[model samples]
Target chain A: MSDREVGGAAEAAAAVIPGSRAMLAVIARSLSPLHGQVTVPQFRILVILADSNVALRSGDLAKALDVHPSTLVRMADRLVARGLIRRSENSASRRETLIELEPAGLDVVRTVTRRRQRDLRRILERMTSGERAAFVDAMQSFTRAAAADADADLTSFGL
Target chain B: MSDREVGGAAEAAAAVIPGSRAMLAVIARSLSPLHGQVTVPQFRILVILADSNVALRSGDLAKALDVHPSTLVRMADRLVARGLIRRSENSASRRETLIELEPAGLDVVRTVTRRRQRDLRRILERMTSGERAAFVDAMQSFTRAAAADADADLTSFGL
Candidate 1:
């Protein structure tokens, strides 16, 4: 394709990404049963926590996910409710609540990752190597641009 | 990185796509300057009509976007109010209001596509060719897996 054609396609593809994201949200919702029952956002929080060596406080999780503190509070509440994480007073700070993933949560993450890998493998098998390469490159470019666009105005929205 | 490591990274990267999609939603929201007061959803309807090359009733748009018919009703009402689309009077189907984008709607799509391509260019410039190639491959795999995973009822919530 010519540069103009490529540009047009990129914009056209960008136009579809939102709907694709919504579809992925549905996919994430469907995966809740593979592990112990958990919401996708809650599991995302667990993955972030499990990946970190140190326990994360609620505020840190909120910052990492670019979500409101109240949203993190609600997520933390749900995770705690599900026994996937424990919330208690921080040893170093009285005002902070340190969040730690329990063994069950760790197991859940493993199971979920395995399931996703299997799904990914099947999906990758369908693509030509070149097509796969192009798709990932597009995603990275799209992501970086979106992030820059977002960071340009952090407080523009309430979030 | 090995395939395993690359896959993990892709999964991590995949987590960011939803946030990017949300940013696009924000961009869609910022279309007021071009729209001269059209709603984002109305613009979306226009784009969908323009892209389809065939008249689509409000119900089809709602279903395609996973929104409610009433939402489509409201959006259709706004588009018709602005004279960017006219509801066809159908003798065969009185209930179905077939929609076609007007010349004004076409102008809006052209402007939106241009702005989006500029954002796309900014993103593509940030990556090395090799990195871009690998990233694109990874994304294609990730999206393919994600779509299949959804179809297979596999949720990534555990990870």
Candidate 2:
């Protein structure tokens, strides 16, 4: 496309995307309390552990988060220091270490997630019920498509 | 709400939000070239210039971006160094400096934005036409609400 046409398309797209970039920033700001306690990467780790309900080996956690093993190790060290997560030797594999969320970590995730929910609920309340239903359906479809791409990427990596 | 109830609400909200957090990460990854050349905050500056179609005072740019003056200055310096943006003293006011996108900067913005549009279009293609229309409507509503909140905050700040 010509530069002018590209600019026009971008303006149109920007109008349609609902300022999601800004809303995401606002949501992140609302989670400042949790951020004060743990960085976003660490919080992700906690969330993964809370969601899985099982200890994950270090390599597995790194793979799941798409972070380098060394980066994950550093983040894990910080979380361990803060008592938000624990590192334990894997029973099934003597050479591997398992990462698990602590009670405190779970609490943090719960609190932050609840706050995010309340914030999102307020946003949804601005729309009519029909709009909300439509949004839910549309978003579900988008997420499904994105998840499929993620799965394909994982498969390529032999994950 | 009780903790359990809050947890349930959060889970439901998570299911409904279409993994926006992850989608954002994916989008950011797709813009890796732009990111490698300019940080996100710097890119926002170029976008603002492109959208306004006119030069903006440094203070006004910082205000629009919700960033600290020092931070904006640092980012501007980097952009200027890369020749993507230019900084000039305002002719009307010696104390004020104007920031404008260089041709290079505008080109970069257009390229990245077009790439983003293509990425979003691919995702939308996975949905039926009806779903795409519904999504556009829903996202428009959500963006309007978020913009209103932003305006309210700005007003409260006497900006």
Best by DockQ: 2
Instruction: Report the Cα lDDT for residue B103, model 1.
Output: 83
Q: What shift in Å separates residue A70 of candidate 1 from its native position after superposition?
A: 2.9
lDDT of 1 by residue, A44-156 (tens): 78777777746888888898767899999998888788888988788788999898888888878777655544544445445655555555456556566556655633322
Q: What lDDT would each prediction earn against the true structure?
A: 0.60, 0.69
Interface RMSD of each: 7.7, 6.3
Measured against the true structure, the TM-scores of the candidates, in listed sequence, are 0.51, 0.76
| Candidate 1: regions farther than 4 A off | A1-43, A103-112, A127-159, B1-55, B65-91, B98-120, B127-159
Best by lDDT: 2
lDDT of 2: 0.69
lDDT (10s digit) by residue, model 2, range B34-93: 746886667778877887789899888888777798888989999999999998888889
| lDDT score, candidate 2, position A28 | 58
Winning model by TM-score = 2
How many Å off is the CA of B58 in candidate 2? 3.1
